[model samples]
Target: MFNINYKSQHPIYEQIIDQTVLFLMEGVLQGGDKLPSVRELATSLGVNPNTVQKAYGELERRGYTENIVGKGTFISSSHQVEKDLAHQFKESLKEIFYEMSRVGFNSDYIQQIVISVLKEEEYVTDTKS
Candidate 1:
């Protein structure tokens, strides 16, 4: 289930990769889960086949998926944490926090905002991140 947003500044291939990672993180997709063919996904998302291929290529390079000849692509059997994605996510958060600080948002205020969002999203349970 890919959600493509043409109006967003983000590229479609990156969105596909992001959503795939989210699915893995949320346990909606697990080790050995089969992914649609690039052609199928491209047709479904109304994107170029090369776009889907690029996304899948990046995912494989990050060790998130495996492509076996004739069998098709699948989620990695080990399903280990994607280090590149984690690093990039942390770096992006750092940039956001820096921007927030420049705008007068203190650490405590930012923490509160994070806590509120986590709680509202049902990701909090009396424990802080």
Candidate 2:
């Protein structure tokens, strides 16, 4: 299931893409699991079919999903999926770091913030478990 936030600055397709990747990373969507058809998802989300198609297209490009002729799109099973996701995360982090650096934030400060956030999240997760 997808949730769209109309107020978010992120485009609908990008939001879908991000949520799909998060689902895959969290193991909520596993290998060979079928994705909702574009039309079905669009209707459910009240978005254009083209937007859903764009998200699926990006997922396929990133090796997260595969489209089988006559069979709906399914999550990829290759270990490469994890590798690709890790690489994407690194790239995104690098971009964030660069932006912060441009704004005069030092590496140490960024690292401290990151570590603190990670620790807080870990603590919360541990408590929940």
Candidate 1, number of clashes: 0
Name the top TM-score candidate. Answer: 2
The global C-alpha lDDT for each of the candidates, from Candidate 1 onward, is 0.89, 0.89
Q: How does model 2 fare in lDDT? A: 0.89
**TM-score of model number 1:** 0.66
lDDT of 1 by residue, 33-61 (tens): 99999999999999999999999999989
- For candidate 1, the lDDT comes to 0.89
* Worst-scoring 10-residue span by lDDT in model 1: 77-86
Task: Pick out the ten consecutive residues of candidate 2 with the lowest summed lDDT.
Answer: 120-129
- The segments of candidate 2 whose C-alpha lies over 4 angstroms from its true place after superposition are 88-129
To one decimal, what is the Cα RMSD in angstroms of model 2 from the true structure?
Answer: 5.9
